[model samples]
Target chain A: MADVGDLVGRARDGEPRAVARLISLVEDAHPRLREVAAALTPYTGNAQVVGLTGPPGVGKSTSTSMLLTALRAEGRRVGVLAIDPSSPFSGGALLGDRIRMGEHATDPGVFIRSMATRGHLGGLAWATPQAVRVLDAAGFDVVLIETVGVGQSEVDVVRLADTTVVLLAPGMGDGIQAAKAGVLEIADVFVVNKADRDGADVTVRELEQLVSMTRREVRGRSWRQPVVRTVAAEGKGADAVVRALAGHRAWLEEHGELRRRRVARASGEVEAVAVQRLRAELGELRGGERLAQLAEAVVGRELDPYAAADALVAELRRG
Target chain B: MADVGDLVGRARDGEPRAVARLISLVEDAHPRLREVAAALTPYTGNAQVVGLTGPPGVGKSTSTSMLLTALRAEGRRVGVLAIDPSSPFSGGALLGDRIRMGEHATDPGVFIRSMATRGHLGGLAWATPQAVRVLDAAGFDVVLIETVGVGQSEVDVVRLADTTVVLLAPGMGDGIQAAKAGVLEIADVFVVNKADRDGADVTVRELEQLVSMTRREVRGRSWRQPVVRTVAAEGKGADAVVRALAGHRAWLEEHGELRRRRVARASGEVEAVAVQRLRAELGELRGGERLAQLAEAVVGRELDPYAAADALVAELRRG
Candidate 1:
């Protein structure tokens, strides 16, 4: 209902409603999304994007709240994007999760949005990057993307960040389970939350061993990931996690990997959008009768999938 | 490598090596894939596709092995595609899991393959369907697709099946976790494995309640998903599962849902291949310099992603 330029201007001026409106446009893939993107592009690429992710019951929300307070204490504006890739019916549950951050709900310096991947064609692949851009253009000092689970989609989401912090807790599972979840390589920083609980040291040690066993280099530069201990529920060790984040950010900047990561993220975004557009074109060509016929032929064993795909692509090109 | 026609011919004769080679081609997306598809298409559309999926430690492997035994007992050839969406480093662990099904390793009537979503661009989206087609064309009467974990990718994999079975065991959370994993809607049948355990009844009742609460109709026909109790480790209740599968298949055929489901599957397969081809084209266009330039502009805040996508699509059209 509002003009794109006016919405962008108000978002940059730190109006929560305007920022929410811009993100809704991105989420819904509104027809004016191009206009919104163009209007927001000039003020983008300033926010430091950080990703925090782990398994369920690992206190991700509490840790996010802790980080928000820590960053705000330093006089910085922070935006939180909580992504739930679960079922659409879990919205009520996610609302409960979001209420855990009630202390920061009224803070003028904080902007938080929860995105669900329900009914999305690509399942957060394309929408997330654009949502991050909206937050970045809004002039937030740091944008934290928090995902609910450690599935493939979550990994892809965290990969969009300048710094990715993987949270773990005692009694969740061992390091082998964590590695099997494929979190070892994506973590720029590791937080062993619930540190005061039993087996906290064991978790830290196991993670340290796993990290050492699978040492990785970014852009041919070795930046050994550090493991920090925290009890996020009580807000203990938040500063240490913050320090670890700052260290990773500095390392990334020193290695000139930040721009490279951003470019890579942008490249993925462009590819997703292009492929999505191609799919849409294929779905729309001849009102999908061509595709339906090709599928029927394939099902009838008169044609192979590759041949069917070729025919569909040809139709798309002609269209 | 053997010629595609020769390999396909051997595979149709039930040569295990030939079957393995053909699947490798599909897995690696080899250049001769189109030839393989053409050679195998005529023999497809004959195999029954059943997808078995659940949370980890839900006895999926055991149930799959049990079903293999049951199907083989009925003189029907069975093919198993156990998809592991876990870490690539967990290959050794997966090998151990695969060895659990070693009883039929030497059976000429059974073909088994374990597919890991490692280093794949689409993460088993395109590969699994082709792999299933290979087994289908190779004279396998039934193809069972078993996926580990209940993530979004697993759900997508199971959607390719004609009958989807969601397995659960006692103490593996409750109905809510299963619902949140988005498996309830995809399941045509639910298997409560390890039914001898203490909480098995409760799990079954919870699942039944959840299924009733979320009752869905297929093409205007209401088919209530049935919950079967099974102690798969001891090979009990597998015959019941087979019966349930048969009942569902018969229902599908009677309602013409079988052809509709197959056509839908083929359509998805076509769409995935079309999208993948477009992505490959985009990656190869102008040696990717054009894409890199677009990404740099987007990252530098000079162009929005939609505009970047538009420019890339323009280049693709010209090409």
Candidate 2:
């Protein structure tokens, strides 16, 4: 086994292989995860963590790459964490993001890694904060977390970031979906990608109306959700996205919401870890034995599921 | 303040008001949830739980009403649970499902209710199985759960049902998304609604190929997902859909998969409940006290999040 301190030291020295190996440890749930996290904690909080998400085929990868280029031109070291919520059917999936971002493979100042979240162990929500810390500590000035805007868990991952960007496309199904569900509140900044496509103006107008409707005076929410347009494939309006991100960041900092948001993030992480830990401990306390009995009781209609669950909780607590 | 047994009794007698109250308790996470579950336990497992899901604009509600018509034609009492994963921005939202199913409002043999998952307490995944039990015990011969096909929690709700129907429209962009994600694996039957539209055949063929690819001899899975066509707006092809459901039901019973699926469902419910219970318990025992300290420790970089999380777990165990 590689020495944890050595790996951390090499990562701090900006060694790419060491950074990759450390992330591997994070993904594999390595035994030395506690040690690795402790060693890397001090170097965190320096990177500006930004998350980008959108429905599939909305050019999320294109926007991410363009943002990377714009950020890189400013001489900032950037790291990208692209995650696909792993599905049951697709065993060895070929992600579109990987192919889309292939041009940046040889860029030394840029680090990119792909994660497939099978929700094993603590799952993506747990693994991501730790992984972000790794990249943050490894001297990335900006860390970008991108996911296909599908699944609750995937959306939850972006919530941990300092700023969240929700992307939409024109003349497709994305605009209606964003309207149907809870997409309004999640977007700190919205980017209408594929701006060259037909009905782009309609999509923009529709989004503007939704944003205005959300930031109504009755609710008393101060921060306005800004919708920017970008043809990411052509690198058009990429600068506008970066400007919008900075504008949101400034607003967050000015309103003292950044500190509050970070605290909430920290509190959430602690709770998530605690919950996952308790779950594992309970699983070892003859949980399967008791669970089988309780489940059988439920199936036989002898006891309600709530009662069985209460009994199981008591058993684990006693253990 | 109604007695749990009384409410269950009234619900079993097809009292719409009582049924509505019981489901409201389910939604509100009423303190009497445990008692309600116990009272309704024996009367469950009689209803055929059919889950219908598809991407937005795929006509899930339309098909649900049509299916309700077909099932009611056979003199079977039917209940509907249409859930919208509640968005943070939309409070008191007017759900499309409720409006679409409005025509069946006066039908004595049908009960349709809507649930919005704000993830209060145990979340929709934990709450839904119990809710289904309530409807089942209320003497409904069939319970149909209709949800917009987005996010993992929404999809997980379908897994609790006996048969899952994945709906698709001809022109809307659901086919690619379903193919990209794991929807193919979760589907037992596919409904190609809006069959009169152009490209309906292509959509059917696409689903057929994807479903076939999933059920290879190497996997040793014998179940083949059947695709049925429907023009739900005009009530065309509803009988074919009903026949398809019955065929799948017979297949499930003959193959002994029904009992196994229910057992698995029971087991999952038990686990979900245990996890939620443990989370709440851990929240006690000076829960907020240790959480703040741990969050501070993690933020200060004195301890890595993993180590801080480990320490928090230790504190909870000690409590």
Q: List-wise, what DockQ does each model earn?
A: 0.45, 0.36
- Cα lDDT, all candidates: 0.85, 0.80
How well does candidate 1 score on lDDT at residue A145? 94
- Candidate 1 residue spans exceeding 4 A from truth: A87-95, A170-173, A176-182, A197-221, B87-96, B170-173, B176-184, B198-220
For residues B127-223, write the lDDT of model 2, one tens digit per residue.
7887788888999998898877655567778878999998888876556667767778788999999999999998898888888787723135487
True contacts kept of each: 0.53, 0.51
Any idea what lDDT model 2 has? 0.80
Tell me the spans in candidate 2 whose CA falls farther than 4 Å from its real position.
A13-21, A24-32, A54-59, A83-94, A118-122, A148-152, A167-184, A190-236, A247-256, B86-94, B168-184, B194-224
Question: Residue B17 of model 2: what lDDT?
Answer: 94
Question: What 10-residue stretch in candidate 1 chain B is worst by lDDT?
Answer: B85-94
**CAPRI verdict on model 1?**
acceptable
Instruction: Evaluate residue B116 in candidate 2 and report its C-alpha lDDT on the 0 to 100 scale.
Output: 72
Clashes of 1: 0
